[model samples]
Target: MNTPPNPAAGAASRIPEVATDASLVVPVIEEQAVVRREVVETGRVRLTKTVEEHPETLNFTLLHDEVQVERVPVNQFVADGATLPGVRYEGDTMIIPVVREVVVKRMLVVEELHITKHEVPTQESHQVVLRQEMVQVTREPLAPPTPGPPPAS
Candidate 1:
């Protein structure tokens, strides 16, 4: 899927360096950078329906049997062209599947969340004890970039 970086492009775009500071080794700063995260939900048993086997007793499960689940979607019960019935369009959440545009302009979620961040500055040399942590601060999401049509050649 990825084309190799062109050798000609690499050679042509090389930065001209100033050979003033003739240091033997350049220092590299390293810190704990969280790359991948697995959001763990504790005791997350959503539905635990158990069927006990008994010969005499048969459970009558009366669901929407006549409802066309195969041909039609639950959200599209009123037909596509027909007017949408009582749809909630509040902020962040949207209903438009194809274009994926939000129906509601703004919906506010109010919650008190604790956050923590450790900023380490450059130090000549230092030592510290290792520690474990659980809770941290949540940052506000950044705005999405402007979308445009494909560039015409």
Candidate 2:
């Protein structure tokens, strides 16, 4: 088959082709995410403690101890060289023995003392001051941070 001549091929053949050794440089671009955290004060809390005193009247029962002593005469003779009796107690009364020496060189019982104790109760009133503690809580607002130089780019 017979082929026709192409016009674009003839024009490409007429242009002079130049030879060069120069290199081409291209820059690459990248994108990244940045994250940061900072501490900030919003408000403040305050605690207050106080003590209060109040006068009060108190009532109580008081106990008092009273002692009574009585002496009784007893004429009794004991054997010679007998030992003296010691003090003894009967219920709430305490008995003490008294002895004497006769002219016949014998021991004689003279008198005895009986002592008793009693407790008496009475009502009494007294004035007293009592202390109490009180607590109060309050919230305070904090001022914002002062303006400063802008961050570097």
Candidate 3:
């Protein structure tokens, strides 16, 4: 069977028969990832604060210091060059010496002061008001959009 050659193929074959020594430049294609972000409101939260107060009774012990002072006479003569007595403590009492020069050029101890300290504890009660803040949170969901009438033609 003899078939006539296609006119388009004959035309394309006779167009060009090029012998090239140059390299072919073909563009390479690749896929790249692009990231984007958007904000959407899903729900709403409402916070409420309230202050509350209440009465409270406080109880504790209080300490008080009491001091007692007493003077005792000690009219005693020391030697011509004896050293004067210094302040001394016996247990919790402090004894302070008082010295004076007599007519005979001798040192005399006139009187001594004795001081003692005492601690007294007392129970105390007081009424006071205490305040506290309270917070309440309420979550509301987004309401669906209502459908409106169609736009005017």
lDDT string, candidate 1, 51-136, tens digits:
44433433343323121111212332334454434323334232332121135532222221222223334334334444444444
Candidate 3, residue 110: how far the Cα is off, in Å: 1.7
Residue 47, candidate 3: alpha-carbon lDDT: 99
- Count of clashing pairs, candidate 1: 5
Where does candidate 3 stray beyond 4 Å? 1-34, 145-153
What is the TM-score ranking, best to worst? Answer: 3, 2, 1
Provide the global lDDT of candidate 3 against the true structure. 0.89
Per residue, candidate 2 scores C-alpha lDDT tens digits across 1-153 of 889989999998986554576555558999998877667788998999999999999999999999999999988887656677779999999999898888987878898899999999999999999999999999999988799996665
lDDT digits (tens) for residues 1-153 of candidate 3:
999999999999986655587565568999988776667578899999999999999999999999899999999887766788999999999999999987888989999999999999999999999999999999999888578895454
TM-score: which is higher, 1 or 2?
A: 2
Q: Going through the candidates in order, what is the number of backbone clashes in each? A: 5, 0, 0
| Candidate 2 lDDT score relative to the true structure | 0.88
Best by TM-score: 3
